[model samples]
Target chain A: MWGHVMSDEKKPVRKKLKAASEASRFMANYYHELDAASQKGQPKIAWCTSVGPAEILRALGFLVYFPETHAAMLGATRMSTELIPEANALGYSPDICSYLTADIGAFLRGVTPLSRIYKGIEAIPKPDVLVFNTNQCRDVQDWFAWYGKKFDAPVLGIYTHRNVGKITEAHVASIAKQMQELIEPLEKVSGRSFDLDRLKRVVALSRACSELWRNVLETASAKPSPLTFFDGTTLMGPAVVGRGTREAVDVYKILLAELNDRIKDKEGAIEDERFRIYWDGMPVWGRLRAHSDLFSGLKASVLASTYCNSWIFSALDENDPFNSMARAYTELFIVRSDDEKETYIKKMLELFKVDGVIYHDAKTCPNNTNCRYGMPQRLEQQTGLPSLTINADLNDMRMISDEQTQTNVEAFIEQLEENQT
Target chain B: MKSKPCYAGVDVGASRTKVAILDTSKNLIGHAVKKSGTDFTATADACLILALKMAGKKKSDIKNTVSTGYGRKNVSFARDTKTEIGCHAKGCFLYFPFATTIIDIGGQDNKVIKLDRSGKRTGFKMNRKCAAGTGAFLEEMAMRLDVSLEEMNGLASQSKNMIKLGSFCTVFSATEVLENIRQGKNLPDIVKGVYYSMIKRVLEMDALTEKVVMTGGVVAHNAFMVKMTEEMIGRKILVPDYPQLTGAIGAALYAMQNKP
Candidate 1:
């Protein structure tokens, strides 16, 4: 939990006023609908997302799998793009979105090269229900909408509105109540008992993951840093799909061992690492190498990203799932308002101690992009950290200005270096 | 002494592969396009062989080979694979140096390229995601109702009524097309709706949206440029003689360049 603590300087402090007046009544009406008298079997629900939201749901005992994560690994191996045309022939528009078109294309062609959903290249299993949080990008939301329409299943869009200005008590209460209400539907669908104890356990797991993630970020504070964002990214997959599980914990332990070994050797994710930069916002989905090479020549190592640390909440499950999940979901960096968002950045600067931040203003993504204008200014003014705002689409070339983006990044790094002396 | 071997540039597109051949002086000796096959290797070979036969040269006469498009890396025969972006920039510089913006509406993807006087890749954007305005989207709608792609465009230009394409998703748009038809909207008006909707989608991504016009698959098939789009944006969109084949010609001419 980067934070959800109450702050005073923040304004527009309206505490769950609407929920108190309206949504609360709806919640009571729905809660009695369950009452342990009418509800029977817990519905078989599956959580779906990229790395960020998957970890949060995993803590709550929800079975989760990441389609984008699976798709990216395929893309990394160069399978999805190959399947684009066939997917188009099957009625998926190639222009609709590359990932969707490609994956469906691969499915239609029946020639995808992936080995498995997990290692050893096995078949992917489909879940009865899908849950997604809208903290990452709106594309996931739209993509999931297709999934919902195709499967004709219930689609839950968890909107985590970013508080760009400042946070107040009203903000926390408004969101907390939303979180409590959002889960009731799940309880109705799953028939899983919702108790304070369960949420607390989920919260504890969130804290553990966040704590481990914080330690990893702290490792970047070293001069000529022992770890790179690549190392952090690889470790993130486990959290993405298996968080709150014993398997996820083991995945991190193994990854941590490997990363620690590399750090001790003073080896970077890529050798000849020079600049240690922070990557903010969603990754350019398709042009990953191009995105990396945009700064690769500068010896720049993107050590931390806002997306990578997004799900890292501080509250850990001492025990129970309800309190833990409630607190953790409520505490997500993107889910919180001005107080939490600003404080999260401040904490990252204190922890990672990086010199620069490249705020990737993903063109189509309002959730991540909305925070940039005011956020960069505030972070720089207080931390004295140099920041550059680059406009590019997340994973789509439709919005990237490669030449201008390159020139900007180069100039920003130069300006940063000039000031270091 | 070794003679400077000829080079081949083949664009294995979604529906077709347009190939071009050039010698040491980088002159375009021959050019041909064939229906792209199901397999990448087969399509690459068919296009290359056709270009070679037209050039009166053997496969060995080809010193180097380049493949571009989404299938760039899959070309088992290519010496090196460059993205369609790089190749398009090189080709557009050679073909239309003054054309600041290049819009390529292939069967599936829509890409907008910005080039400098020197043809360097100044910046470019592709609709890697979203199908609200692509040529493929229009084609699907055309086939669903058993209307020809040509008739889809021609009939659309004839209509004056506005048929709003409310949903941004392609499948949903197809459904919307059907829904409009059920609502007694005339065939021509439905076609008009698709063209108008596409232009709006294009405007969202193109930095030079208002200033540019037809030069890809969409221009050729549904040859009618969305007049409403031009009027809405208040700018003229330049249309080349053959918008469909411009990219191939651009690729062919790019191969003609002697410059490194």
Candidate 2:
């Protein structure tokens, strides 16, 4: 609800800075696969997780692309799933993963069913280097492998280890060598030097912003506080993409100011949070809105979520990007077991002060699986909080049961109300 | 009399191929299940041939044919192919009509589907790239449990203590099962726990928060259906009367609707 105020005379300049200039800088292109035009004059080459990849590339004055995001967009608009049988018809087969087949179709057809949104997509200049992190899905590795073979583009991949609780010597050495390798192409692409001091300084700025954002989440524990996970979703951009920069600092200052004002005013982000809720694990990208909409329609509010947070406060800490990254990886609820996942779940429940948790075990993810076989029962045994678990790809809706899901949720709430009495 | 219009459906299961045939109104005329071969097309043909013979109809007698399952399109006979999902949704809605959610735990993969009142394919989450909590996993355990695949469920119902199958990955779950056995955990509890573990993976993968209409080869065969429902969802699970045939029925209906 807070708008940036500007002097009347400087309005035009601020508008350009926010929209046009920044849009030009948002040049990061992070597609899992780049099509073959064999064009030489590409802008930048980089990779990132589905969430941070595009934003980081843009920060580097590069264009960002993502195959999964494109796939989800297709699923969202309903054109991609419609073409599944056709793709399978041509030879892909029903056995093939839909993302690959749909992408192959979208590439061959030359126009996505919703092509206008990504105009000049294929024509965007070539990437100087491709950058990626092994954070979400292992399919990313294969996706990039295909891209590397197709374009023979210089690829830089980051390893966000799945099962490891801490970064071992092997993990550090492998990625350290990778980080060393990143130096050459990155320098060659931007024609800029990889200044270690500059990078550290930038990460520090990012850390500051994250701390503030983390505090924003922490403050929500109080009676009527500033923001919710919904508002924080909008605020997640800078911490992810705009980190380690003066602009990052400026943007966060504005956000924290608004939040503090809300705290002083004793108000919540929304007018009336009908049913406070906590979201556990990654936010189902395709279903995020549908999820929120479903809950919102029922006058149920999602006050916080694990996906929107992603342990940002810890990972973005200035103490040593390497050490901090490793420490953050160790704390992830999915990669750990027993005490860790339970401790975090308890913390989230306590911090969000919500009545229940909607856990999203995204299909196709290796690191995320749990709490069945009386596991959720254990949660019931321990925390005495209600738990609702559902299955479906984070975005793929080829098979989802919304009505049944709604029924379960309503019944759970009914039981919760009865229990409280 | 109108020539009996013959219809066919094939299920490309993990270890086996099941085929069914029906007249135009969709009454099952004949059905056959056979071990799947290595080659895709050959397995499909063998299943189709067996099903056609059982229906007492030559391949040429079929006016229209629809194919479903993992191998639907791989079959040379299918005019077109649809995912096991669309066919299942269509098939389940025809039977239950009010079934808004369908959970199919198959041999190779677990598919959780959400259907509308009219049986339109809406949203879904299939399992990861491997078999974690699926029919294949169950069979492997059944072999170790000394219970026939057909009798494992019945034996499971007779057990007293809960064996903990703690691993979520099938590979890990297998090792974990052996470890629990070595630790002297009761067999029924272990089998029940294994089923629950698989159910848990399905829950995380699909985001399932509903009363699920459970169907598939495993649901029909598993005797611990009640315990599985309670453990996986911490609630009750409902299944169709003849759950295993849902996929075949869906395939036939899909074949009939889009016949061109």
Candidate 3:
């Protein structure tokens, strides 16, 4: 009774960015420099959070290392699941941020994914100090504290107000004052005096890189976007790790020009871009390629995302580096209330001309996951666009249900098709 | 005799495989359901043959075929595949033809799909990383109770005092069932509690609209679930004539509608 079935449809091919190699080299160089400094102990190494005060560390002549970046590498290399249980064995709940668990687990196991990429790198650079800003989540503080205790390094952090709707002068002053206090501890750790001129120059470089990154993201607003959120996640390396440096600014410049050229030539990241979707919440670091392929196969382009756009620090002003840095970090989307978040998402949807939104209800990272608070329903009611919530984690592969995700995403695309017709 | 042109739909669920045949008039003329087993392609072919025999038709008579559910892509005879969510929404909408909240409790998963008055899907949600409130849960509970899956529905109907299960996880619920059994609770009451827990789990997945429809293999075998759901929601719940075949029927409808 068996009859012939149709052949499988053609799979969509992803277009590679020409500047990706340059970005990779730049990142590798940054890591190599940190490794060198850690080995020589000439310029002390300071571990900073991804969104922490890296500019100050750079100005103090300390090589800055971001553990979150290392955590992402662990996730992308698909080694997080194996190492995460090590942290759980240390009495850390599996429910906390997977990045934290995976990083600590790797440390406890004395392994690094970076060692495979860069030869002779035994582990992440040893830190003389660890700095963090609690604007993103309290997990960063706790995550840094563990390393601080292990390395016998001083752990310093700037605690910012949560659920912030408006940034008042008082809020900026409070954060700026706290950042100013870090100068003394940072100087002692690095054995270099604080220089305001150098800080201004570093902040200015960071501001230039942020603008270029913002411009690269905005290029997706064009018809048939030149880049996808998956691309943004990779290309934002410099903006996240090498920020406040001339090299970061140069990398973004090369990337922006390449994207602009793609737009000029009417090129798209995917073979077909029939639907534009806005992704909210954290990236499923391990499944980026799979998710990208799934959407590309459905003729959809995830044009914009809150995670990639988090790197845009437009409020950074060189003239008032400390206060502007304070204002910029405080105004982050993750640190904002639901009201502010909703307004920001609505604006992004319009800017990108999105047909739908997909909310990643990441299992481990509640701070980054927004769908639990009825945001998807509220956004749909306001925008009249359909939304789908996929439950997965950034680094925890155990939480993902691949079959369910495929079914839900396919059904969501069908719903969007019906709406369009 | 010249056979009339017909369309077919096959739904290869995790537990069962179903097939439905529809004539040009859109009437479900024939259907069949069987254990999916290991070979989805063979089971699907067997179901289609049985359904076609019932319809008094042959393979050559079917103009188009569509497949749905978990093993949808495994149907070698199907020309296209649709998701279970869309098929369920379409199947329920064909009967009610109005705004509806469709709760489908299948073997391995559950879906809460919302449709507008025009039969367009307004929203949808699926169970995340769990198998509670599904046929698999009921089967596990039945195994724990040392009863057949078919007997639980009838046992639930005969309950005098229904024992409420506190846990929604299937594994935990199974342990709870054992505890109640150990405490000398009646089998009927415990079975009723299992049904209650299943219904409550699906209801909590999403809100019901003015109209609520229940479908899927679990609902097909358990009529008492529909009655209990009505009593819980304080309203009448709609059920298609063959709730188990709605997804397959909906797929058949798509075949008929999109025929070349």
Give the candidate number with the greatest DockQ.
3
Please report, in order, the local distance difference test score of every candidate based on alpha carbons. 0.59, 0.59, 0.92
Residue A16 lDDT (model 2): 11
| TM-scores computed on chain B for all candidates | 0.81, 0.88, 0.98
The superposed Cα distance between candidate 2 and the true structure at residue B76, in angstroms, equals: 51
- Candidate 2: residue A321 Cα off by (Å): 4.3
TM-score of 2: 0.53
**CA shift of A322, model 1, Å:** 18
TM-score of chain B of 1: 0.81
The candidates' DockQ values read: 0.02, 0.02, 0.68
Q: Whose lDDT is greatest here?
A: 3
Give the per-residue lDDT of model 1 (tens digit) for A143-163: 677667766767775665554
Q: What lDDT is reached at residue A12 by model 3?
A: 83
Tell how far residue A35 is off in model 1, in angstroms.
27
Candidate 1 lDDT score at position B139: 76
Scored against the true structure, residue B123 in model 1 reaches a CA lDDT of 43
* Rank by DockQ (best first): 3, 1, 2
